[model samples]
Target: MTPLTVEVTSSTGSDHLLPSKDPWYTAPADFEASIPGTVLRIRTVPGQPTVFSNAAAAYHILYRTTGSRYQPTWAVTSLVIPKKPCVHSGYNALLSYQMAYNTPTIDRGPSYRIFEPPLPNNYGIPPGHQQFDIMLDRGWFVTIPDFEGPRAAFGASVQAGHATLDGIRAVLSLAGHPDIPLPSSADKFKYAMWGYSGGSIASEKAAELQVQYAPELARGFVGAALGGLVSNVGSLYTVTNKTPYMGNLVLILLGVMNEYPEVDTYLRSRLKTEGPQNATAFLKGRDMDSFQAFQTYAGQDIFEYFVGGEADLEACQALRKIKMVEWMLGYHGAPEVPLFVYKAIEDELTPIADTDAHMEHYKRFNVSVLYERNTVGGHISEIVNGQDRAIKWLASVFDSSYDKEGGIKTRDVTVDIYKPPIP
Candidate 1:
């Protein structure tokens, strides 16, 4: 097959691009690669929606490359916008598209995948599965924003969110072009956000910034679902001590701190001399094997290097004080749109209590709520199957259920005849 390439354009006319071949993972047999205008594109035809009448449209895959500063440099691929008839009118309405991160070879890093595609047929490496596919099945466009930017932007959740939201805008801008079809006369946009794990970080940051960063988007966003949320960095470190979850957490911390000085400073003070080297090694590798290496080399306990011995706890706290306040645990206001949160009761990776504290603030607001606690899945599993419930609930969000009192009326769990676990 001819190697596909997408020329990602900047706000200006300049371009830097990404090749369309799977950087790491194998492309399914049906993957169609096309370069639309300046953007490199891959698409799957719109299929029937299981619930709604609108044909579920898939990606008009798009990508952008940003330098280390995370500035937009070029449009690497054509924005792949999904198409389906609008619910309000028979005419086609433009929904958003998402790009997968950490999937390609050049984009891969030591500790992290650097947002490339999964290794071909490596079933153990998670990310591309149910929720991501289910969103496409339900008619929402999916763009896995390789948020690592052109340089493999990693740990830059806010930056990732911006690209994802902007990608949607780009798709809408293309909907009216002669080549694209409009399903009906009244096809305006309706959007909802969903992601788990690292993707959740991007989605949540986007939600916080929607009103301030992109008010135009704020009006169009119907709701968002965030699963396996990681709120406080310090709290996460504590959770990873004995649990295997520490590996990814370590890589994410190193990835972000290396790019951002404030975080780097925190790591330097907290970690022993070897901590920095360990971090670098971790970032270079993309899978669990590297995680085990970091764990083994650093000794059985990882917390002392992070939080410090009980004797040195005060010093660690002082160093944390010097770090950026917003980066630590910033205040994100109540979401203007409804929120759907799924958390695992036995999640070994992220602390559920931290999520609880954040939700407490949202509950006080007038926003509606649908909460589920799962018993079977871990972080990655919850992200995949959680969608089985989240998407259906999201469909109901479009339906009339909000009470006159501004609270969401109780709807069935939509899962089964049994109760959902509560953390």
Candidate 2:
């Protein structure tokens, strides 16, 4: 198939097209015949003044990837080359910055809204773009994969990992593209991964699955930094149910259902059909963003929508399948590269114990891990407070300065002001 390229000088113009309407997102007739990570389509949306303003150039690659069930599929990743040369280690550094766009909505993916106007109160830039700006400012080329795949399987780990690893392959394959400037040789770049919350699901899964799924790219990876991880989906229900994050339960359910038809059939048969809070209503979350889901279903009981409530849902064989496959981390494999993981001790959305168990699982396999547990913040606050540390650790990883000699290292960070007052 011939590659398609569109030039845009402004965010609002005739060339602007949403992912849903864009033909470039469509896979060619024989895409499945190609190997995973094979570039199917390339759309060059040169950096505009308003969108990705910090980037010297940007391109979107539609590449072959595997779906949740290991079926052939395709995904798009947005790649940005920084204006400045690679100053770190005198070699190009590629940071796959996964965005925490937890929705199953394809249009809500970063590549779609990347050139659109920012939502209100977001400082005139789209959400998640700030992270791109920061990475670009550091002279590191960045790639953000729509790792959820064509179906937008939010909670499916295999699909996320495959798309991410394959996205890197797709990017590396573009080293000699005449239009976009990249190192002539792929080995000239050091790669790293960073993601938080929903994004962590992809980054962590990719790290664990790399050795087996994409062994060729494994040696190029320096490390991965994950924060506010959702290690166990089954365990998360207890913490988020009926809370402000209760809506996430719906999103996960719908997301998993998208990948596993059996789960969808099982859920459809058991969900309450009548009333405003029925299964049909919640399933609409497939098109809603994370914020919309939170606002629409906040403080609502998820079990109440089921025919047999929590008990019947627990007995579901379909749920069990995903619980073991897509919902849980470390079941597939362990990371070949070192890891820097951070989490809030009192995170409201995800349990810290889950991350602790996850880290131990990696440690059992001799995976280098540096775990930091912050005593003072919740899930949201830590994203800001831990930003500096995560970026610093990533920088160290890229520059070959991070220490990885010892076994798993754990640190407990407690601010003096957040400590309990003496009686």
Whole-model Cα lDDT of every candidate shown, in order? 0.46, 0.82
Q: Which lDDT value does model 2 have at 366?
A: 84
lDDT of 1 by residue, 285-373 (tens): 43323334344434334444543543443354533552233233235455576777787756666777777666665666765556566
Which regions of candidate 1 fall more than 4 Å away from where they truly are? 1-127, 151-153, 179-187, 262-330, 375-377, 398-423
Residue lDDT tens for model 2, 1-423? 322231222233437576787666789898899899888877666334256557887777889999977889999998888988565666689999888877777888877766666564211112556767788888899999999988888888889999999999988887766666888778888999999999999999999889999999976799999999889978878888998778888888888888888888988888899887787887888888777888788899989888888986788887877888887999889888998999899988899999999988877888899999999877877777677788899999888899877468999986322222234
Among the numbered candidates, top lDDT falls to: 2
Q: How close is candidate 2 to the true structure, as a TM-score?
A: 0.92
Global CA lDDT computed for model 2: 0.82
